[model samples]
Target: MTELRDAALASKAWPFEEARRVLKRYAKAAPEKGYVLFETGYGPSGLPHIGTFGEVARTTMVRRAFELISDIPTKLICFSDDMDGLRKVPGNVPNQEQMKEDLNLPLTKVRDPFGTHDSFGAHNNARLNAFLDSYGFEYEFASATEYYKSGKFDEALLKALHEFDKIMEIMLPTLGKERQETYSPFLPVSPKTGHVLQVPTLERNLEKGTIVYEEPDGERVEVPVTGGNVKLQWKPDWGMRWAALGVDYEMFGKDLIPSAELSSKICRVLGTQPPELFNYELFLDEEGQKISKSKGNGLSMEEWLTYAAPESLSYFMYQKPKTAKRLYFDVIPKAVDEYHQQLRAYPGQDLKAQLNNPVFHIHGGDVPASDMVVPFSMLLNLASASSAEDKATMWGFIGKYAPDATPETHPGMDAAARYAVRYFNDFVKPEKVYRAPDVQELAALEDLVAALKSPEAALEQIAKKNAVMGNDEPLPEADYGDEDFLQSIVFAVGKNHGFEPLRDWFKAIYEVCLGASQGPRFGGFIALYGVDETIALIEKALAGELG
Candidate 1:
């Protein structure tokens, strides 16, 4: 463990790098809160999205990395700002007519359109927890509604009231003149209407710990800032949360960098250093537009899970966090394949390399052995070829390729097979555009078909031809079961028939036989789907039956 800690200390993986930053916060002394606090905040204004999951997943990775290098206990808080008023109804949810009436009310007081929980905020919070729990993240859920009403934030609220002018000095310059005139850090909840009123404060009394604001109807009302009567504006609230909870670390999207910086300054005015911050680049949709929660433009957490394992999403979150990635259904298969690829590489890696490996942080150093004998991309190809509707059909091909594996022993492979079929039916089937191979591609396909028909004799002749050309590396053993030998045969066919950039050969095969422009390695597909089956598939393409 000490050796692993040494490796972790020097490891350059982003999680370790971020964890090291958190560790430095206590270089002089441990936090007075007893344990280092890591927090991920949720607005709960809309349903929990994939980006929401990414925040917690990435923070957990840093927490896991911290655990490896230090003995200080750590606690992760999944904080929800549910007390904020709902400015508008989310178009995605049901009962829209009912929600329009609840605008400007605290989310906890708004009706749950789903009708499953006490309020919309509670419903969204449940969804967020379900999403986090589905991935087995260890976190304590903190609701703004509960915190404020329970007096948990009372001390912070009083402190903000005492430092009100300082916070206003920090925030006022950033807002336009009109907004600056009316903006108050405190948004008081109107006693009569039960709405969170953002009206201008008429009076400030620090001695009473209350503020006076006039209602729209011209009624003057005085309310204590503490005990859920008032909530701070977003920037001040962010800093207040960090100070109140003694958070050691938190991360947000790059879009929030200015807000985070402003809040960090506010935190200092509140008499606490800001948490260590990691501002990751925001996700983009397929069209390169920034993903918007209200616009519903990108993949959702449930949508990603519908087609791939949670860990694949985590794997996607783990890689190049500072770089913006397109989060869409099209990226799922690649993420799944690459995640398993990393998993397959883990057991052979040394401790230093393991510390840097994504799966180590992803699974919190308890990485599982990958049971995926068949790659996800290949399973999708098989799904396309066989029109597979279930894992059972894919399992037939899986059983033939690796006779020892089964659903009972290789559950992850079983899940991938299921996901592949669903993914193909949903995304691949609709986009398939089969085209007849062009002249060069046709000739290459014919050569490939001929070589596959008599693989053994063709490989032997190709070996002699290579030998005569002074390239005397022996051909891979020409066993029908040998995928590499089959690949070599396909490569020779493509090269001999002069398919420039040889990928054209594979592309031709996919377009003509599989109705897609690119696919898994043809040889591996053939080995798994059967050479005889591939021969018939090509014959159909040639006969115009496939197109």
Candidate 2:
């Protein structure tokens, strides 16, 4: 347990903690392979999506953790089920009519609907590769269509052929009567028309390694199970891939629990235990509806990167992978801000706390060591309040806050300012609802602002100070006012005024001063933006000029 407890402190992550538990079980069960294997599946029925990004990103983090814990090597096999038959024409593609015409054809056999590659599968695979490569993901992508055609899956295909009856018994009872009557463990692609046929198997010969099925036109076809002639049904295919690749871990969506159950059973029946499974909850939209490519509901890759860094998106997925969370654009700022906060504070925390932090893992255990003078959210608030339409206009606020600031000197601020400009224009401008502080709130805020005006507050302390604090303690002798000092001051001031919820104090401060209900942490903002400017901003709001 010491190793396990301290493992979390050694710059490793939870999923790595997860991987370690699974690997211990795997090592006891089977030690044929020295290195652990992690597998993630990509279905190319549509373009690469945020969900796809999440799967790969999460898997990679686990893989990274594995590398840290063990001297043994590891690999992430990104398997693409490109051989699956096209059921319907996807609407996002340009050549929908052509796709409809080629329904039921294997994805790799159908011509590229978007005219980008040799086949639709290849096109989608290329897109997936391009997207993954943009993130510098370390992976080896496996194509089912090519693997089947090249006979790489032939051994597993043969095993399924031999266990055809058993596989059917495991699968058929779970399906509807109609499907049960027609279902087979194998779906053979016609060697002639190249359509993946779903007809019932008329006869199977293990010795000959072939199954006979009749085409819709009443043509009887006998094809060998090996060499791209057949494909195991989805459930059995998943099981076979696990056994065949020696996959020790597989992470999947929560919706596939039933399928995962069946697949694990199939794996057991095939004489191998199921791979270690990690089923993550589905990502939902702002309305809590499931994000689906077919339904077109959720943030897109382009939209996320448009207003936030890729690190922010990575950090979003790193938090509670098993718990359900919204992936809408509105969640973007907080994710970005959180990522920045964790990175900034990583140096201050112990290795244990650092390892537990999301940004610690999102950054591959290497956090950027500098804190931004102003958080991205503060910059957004500042930009929106100033009605600044661009990054250049937002620079003065950041400069005033951090005297030595410039695009080059404070790259984080520069990038954030630029993002704040666009994000303000898109989401913040029309949503502004400033409310004046009431008399009670006003009096407390005035005292706080005056304290901020003293040049001995959160931002100043954050910039140069450090000391442990308790209730109503004098300001830390250090120059910068870190989170502790900020928290202490806010708590003391709010307590003095008998402010219930305490949040209302910050809310009033934010609404009156920043013209938004939420902004950056009040303490950090005050320090970074400096007392005089904050005093002026709050005084103007009190003057009703801001409202």
Which candidate should be chosen as best, given lDDT against the real structure?
1
lDDT of 2 by residue, 1-547 (tens): 3564456535445776776866576554445776778888998888888888889999888887766666567888889999999988888788778888899999987789778799999999999999999998999999998888898888877888888888888998899999999999889998777888888999988998999999888888899988988888899999988877778888899999999999988887777878888899998989999988777788887899889888889988889887899888788888888888788778888767777878767777767765467767777777765778888878876676567878888787778778888998888877787787899988877766655555454334333222222334344543334544555455556656667887878887878877677766776665655546667887888888886
Give the per-residue Cα lDDT of candidate 1 at 391.
Answer: 88
Worst 10 residues of 1 by lDDT: 460-469
**After superposing candidate 1, which stretches have Cα over 4 Å from the reference?**
464-469, 474-477
Residue lDDT tens for model 1, 113-157: 999999999999999998788779999999999999999999999
The TM-scores of all predictions, comma-separated, are 0.97, 0.86
Q: lDDT per prediction?
A: 0.90, 0.79
C-alpha RMSD in Å of predicted model 1 compared with the true structure:
1.6
* Model 2: ten consecutive residues of lowest lDDT: 462-471
**TM-score of candidate 1 relative to the true fold:** 0.97
